[model samples]
Target: MSRDAASRPARERLLDAAGELFYESGIAATGVDAVLARARVSPATLYAHFSGKDGLVAANLERRFRQWRDVWDEVLDERTDPVDRLLSVFDAVVRYRAVEGNRRGCAFLAAAVELPPGHPGRQWLAADSRLLTERLHDLAEAAGAGDPTGIADGLLALYDGALARLARQAATPGLDTGDPLHRARRMAADWLAGRVPPGRPSG
Candidate 1:
């Protein structure tokens, strides 16, 4: 089928359904049949677009990356101050988390853990992480951080740690859960204000 004429709507519908189901329920637990049923498409139509469940999963991951990039671009556009722009990334994360029914942790990390290191999805995750890290580095440089790469690494670490903590807290009740994004924002702002030392370069 041609790219333009292919069952694009069905494909997108499948991707949307997969993202919702896979994130809410574990990817391993969601089957292709369920995805097709949710998308209201037959197995034949789905197969024409994707190789199988794996292909669908990869497509869903790519869709998420696109969504994230779009949001990041919008946030960056809203802030002219580089420091605020950099911190806006965390703000986006917090806003996303605050949305109802957002129980899934990092989708890329979840997919990577489910698949082996050499899996195609793992490869995509690695590439996506590198691109994100580079973007953060560039943003840090623009923000006048003393060491762009080191600051980028520090910010990434903080983000990953915050996400991990949030996921854990989401699982437990009455845990005195603090807002990771706010904590991260305060840390980033302090660093920007020169109150704390910039992180050392990783060897």
Candidate 2:
């Protein structure tokens, strides 16, 4: 480890190492030894801070959820149009991915695929899904959609589809496909406008 990395707290260093490695490679593919080697901390230190690899995985998911929420909150705060605010989740994803240098896809979704049925990491994935579904429902209602649940679920599907496309793009960089998030947002906007009434806040 470099002098700068060495100076940081063990927990932070461990998380930094684990987050990158788990996201870049499959979580199941990344071993605790790899995280320890990258963090330059003893196995005892890792246990003291996070119990084990499962705990560390949970911690990473929680941290990612917080970051995602903060980014989405910022996007909502910046926009006032009801339609724009409703569609801001996509915008938040765009900004978050760029800032975090994440090219694969949604971390929570990735974790969901890798973690076993009863793993604690699944809680954070559920929490992330709840936030998207509940917030989109609320925003859709505020945007004057006749069927808030339907609209919210529709957008949620689009969001998931975009993330899948993102993973494909990352896997094949030369595919020449455009931004999935942008395309998803545009589709949402167009669909929302049609769903919302004439006098209401249409896209």
Q: What is the C-alpha RMSD of each candidate to the true structure, in Å?
A: 5.8, 1.9
Instruction: Kindly report which residue pairs in candidate 1 clash with one another.
Output: none
Which sections of candidate 2 miss by over 4 Å? 198-203
Evaluate model 1: give its TM-score.
0.83
Tens digit of per-residue lDDT, candidate 1, span 1-203? 24553446887788878888888776899988888777888999888998888888878888777777777777777777666766777877766556424764677777876876565566568777986799888877766667888888888888888777776776677764677778978887877667223442221
- Listed in order, each prediction's TM-score against the native is 0.83, 0.95
Candidate 2 lDDT, tens digit per residue, 92-165? 99999888999798888788888999998899999999999999998888778889999999999999999988
Error of 2 at 156 (Å): 0.8
Cα RMSD for predicted model 1 = 5.8
- CA lDDT of each candidate? 0.74, 0.90
**Which regions of candidate 1 are displaced past 4 Å?**
1-8, 97-101, 195-203
Candidate 2 has a TM-score of: 0.95
Cα RMSD (Å) between model 2 and the true structure?
1.9
